[model samples]
Target: MAKPASIPGLNPEILAWARRRAGHDVATVAKRLRKSPEDVRAWEAGDASPTYVQLEKLAYEIYKRPLALFFFPEPPEEEDPEHRFRTLPAFELARLAPDTRLKIRDACAKQIALHELTGGRNPAERLVFRDLASTPDSDPAGVAEKLRDYLGVSVEEQRSWRSAAAALARWRESIEEHGVFVFKSSFKQQEISGFCLYGEEFPIIYLNNSVAKTRQIFTLFHELAHLLLRLDGITKRDDSYIGHLRGEEREVEVFCNAFAGAFLVPQGVVRELAGRGAPADDEIKTFATQLKVSREVILRRLLDRGVVSRQHYEQKAAEWTDDYFERRRKSGGGNYYNTQGVYLGKRFLALGFQQLYRGVISRAELADVLGVKATSLDGLEQRMLAGTG
Candidate 1:
């Protein structure tokens, strides 16, 4: 059996961040930490203690937060000192599993700054949101097609899937007043990997700026689902399981998953292939290669559609995971998503950076908002001007 994950006595700040990041309640963490929930609470509330070694182990598991995050005394404020991106002291909590941490930090950054960036609700806006919420019988497939057409992209002509997705996002920019940009950050202290926040105006999806291309592609589709559904919230999870969902969030998750599935690889085509008869391993591989998506994604869709039974799907997924990673490792280079540069498309980055450059926002302010340096902004501005950023 696998060894159980341990937790040390965490300080209140670190404990609180860990609990929230892991989405584990106090009682649950207490069990993992080998203490009562109340004991864990006291430790988080500054009333009790966990030893240093214990803290280290606990920090390692929950959000992969560093022991220093717990010991830092005063945490960094939410806003970054440079004003490029929101200053995130809790970022250290994200360093645990790099992929997972990046995803979580992306979510945290979105949630923390969404309100300020999106601003107060407009009266007309609420009605629009209400209408969108109430709108029924809306065809999700049609929505996907509409989005595709709006972007002036035909699935047939696509070479780079990430580029196609970015183009779609760019098209989305023209219709909405708020800025959309692909954001990336190396969250040193964070434990999770990606997240999203639907703002009153601009809804941002943050990806763990540290992961490979295939994963980023999934994260992008996942966040885009959040945008389409118009839900406001944050999500932090590893791809360990499908997801941990509850309340309205579950509905959104379903929608997003559906949207991603349909957008990345059309369901009808997948269903048709599966209907043809039992697909060989090479067939699955060929489909993944043609679609330019991870094989695991292809299997997941097949499983969801009942084209493959649970046992078969799980086995195939496992095999695909091993093969995919091996291929990636052997390539000795970046994957599609990573090579695509930032997760956000260049068009949105240009728009977003310009919004800051035109003196609408001070350079310093822009830097802090983006979690980049002023010098970096200078380079970004030049890149945007060149239409290549």
Candidate 2:
């Protein structure tokens, strides 16, 4: 690119933002840009100016703000009154997807029209989750780095599935720019493991009550991938199943899968554990055990990386998934997803109760907050008090 004529004027705000966003010393940017650090500092201080060519290159490489932001006087940041991150009442999300919480309010505004048309049924409530409904601008690689930093776990941190789940919790905690929530309930007759409520603070994850501990862990990560992709939608897959979608949803799903795979079993770490070479079926199982992920997940990863074949992966994965269901059925022939919901939901409810008793809120209101009957809250309170006393 030809360097343009030196411009007489430049915006200080633009240079300052680049300095802060890069989080590096002015000297560093100068060295990389092959300019004197003093000049860089002067440019930021609005004492020196860069040519149009230099400004264009700087704008593209760092900060990524449009050239207009530098010149235009920025209006003060307007904060939205309804920040979705705040805790909302449970009735607001009953059987609803997280992403549509905002829309749900709008629907309520048209309640008379909607109720007259649908006869008091709100099917859209259940369909509009936030996790599968977001629009993320960053790529998977960028998201992976953000997740690692947010969770405070290194890409090299290979641990148990439980530990990985804990890491996911940290990731949720790290998300300040976006909203996330865990929606738990004893969903009778529904086989849903969990769904994301995309683009809402109160994103819903519907955990099924009937799933095994191992399977539930996988579902947690799978739904999390939906969140990263900002997809406002639903996804159901058997263990280690890669979605073969097309179009916009396909792009997001692919990115989600990549994020989940990296978070669960980082490529570099897995490659090292595989002895820097492909391992056999038995060896892959051993690796899975070591990684604290399902054998199918590991096998698929290996196969995708050319460490295994389609035939080898499917043959082994089918056996594992089949035997898994068989063993689970033998122990208790119940819906796996529903079972998880009840167990985890009870725990979450307990926390909600404590928040109530502390006078942080009213008992009736707390029940309302969680979408449970007042009688249910009273019963749970008695049980909790009895157990403690």
Identify the leading candidate in terms of lDDT: 1
lDDT of 1 by residue, 1-389 (tens): 85334334334675676566554577767787788888878777877677666676677775466667776655545422122212122342333343443444554554444434435333122222223332113455666565555445565644354543454343334323334334554444332335555554555666654444444566666666565566532323333322444444445556666666677677566777779676777887677666666666677678777777878876766665566446755765444333333544454444447656566667777666555567776666555566542
Candidate 1 lDDT (Cα, 0 to 1) = 0.54
- The Cα error of candidate 2 at residue 69, in Å, is 51
For residue 74, give model 1's deviation from the true position in Å: 12
TM-score of 1: 0.58
Give the worst 10-residue stretch by lDDT in candidate 2. 80-89
lDDT of 2 by residue, 156-228 (tens): 4546334534543444333322333344333332234444444433334444435444445556666666755
On TM-score, the candidate that comes out on top is 1
Give the Å error, residue 167, model 2.
7.6
lDDT over C-alpha atoms for residue 207 of model 2: 45
